[model samples]
Target: MAGYGRSDEEWGQLTSVGLAFLVERARLEKTTTYTELDATLRRRTGLRGFDFDQDSERAAMGHLLGLIVERNRPTTNLLISALVQYLNTNDAGPGFYALAVELGMLPRRSSATAKQAFWIGQLNALYAFYSAGRRGA
Candidate 1:
């Protein structure tokens, strides 16, 4: 299978490390003030303000990751639209997506297919990494 030029073992190592970092970052972001998070999301998604609570925003982050793995356009678009309408979202612009790129979920932005391939590769690697862990356990 195509990977980020890494062997299965290497990919697993990267995924484990990257996922740990992302989750911890999520937890930290949860602790920030709502006003601060709102401003950050505004800068990220170009939305005006946030109206949802911390819990909802946290849930949305998980939901976003799931959607990324699913790689369904309609569902992804629906999620994005809902977030825009409600002003509840994740720090994906500078957070999860960035990690995704580093983990080889996406090609560099200059690549022609970077946008399309990003989510697909990420989902593939995510499932691969977790499945490997489960088997080991």
Candidate 2:
């Protein structure tokens, strides 16, 4: 994921929630329309990148909300808005790990336990998933 003011340490490492969170944050800072939201969501999501966090997720949703409040393209605005809704309600276990597995974001082989590998694998998985799939892309 692209970031504005992040430290180098935070650059290539983030959870799915963390990555989702970042998109939320960026969308907030930049103005977006329904057309913009949909287009941006599809465009950015179509690529492969980082996993956002709560702050970022909220920020992206905030951008969509701004569109609705401002009366921009309500459809696109609401479309992204629903994503925020899904994120809020859905459990992360399945969505989180599945993406990691499907995208082949994990290490090829490691002695780490399932939990360790998952966490390590999750970083790349979350980034690819959110940046390249239906969730956003």
Alpha-carbon shift of residue 55 in model 1 (angstroms): 15
Could you list the CA RMSD of all candidates, in the order they appear? 15.3, 16.4
Supply the TM-score for candidate 1: 0.26
Evaluated at residue 99, the lDDT of candidate 1 is 45
Q: TM-score per candidate, in order?
A: 0.26, 0.21
**Which tens-of-lDDT digit does each residue in 61-135 have in candidate 2?**
443343332232221222222222232332223333333344454444423366355553433343443443335
Model 1, residue pairs in steric clash: none
In candidate 1, which residue ranges exceed 4 Å CA deviation? 1-94, 100-108, 132-137
Best by TM-score: 1
- For all candidates, the clash counts are 0, 21
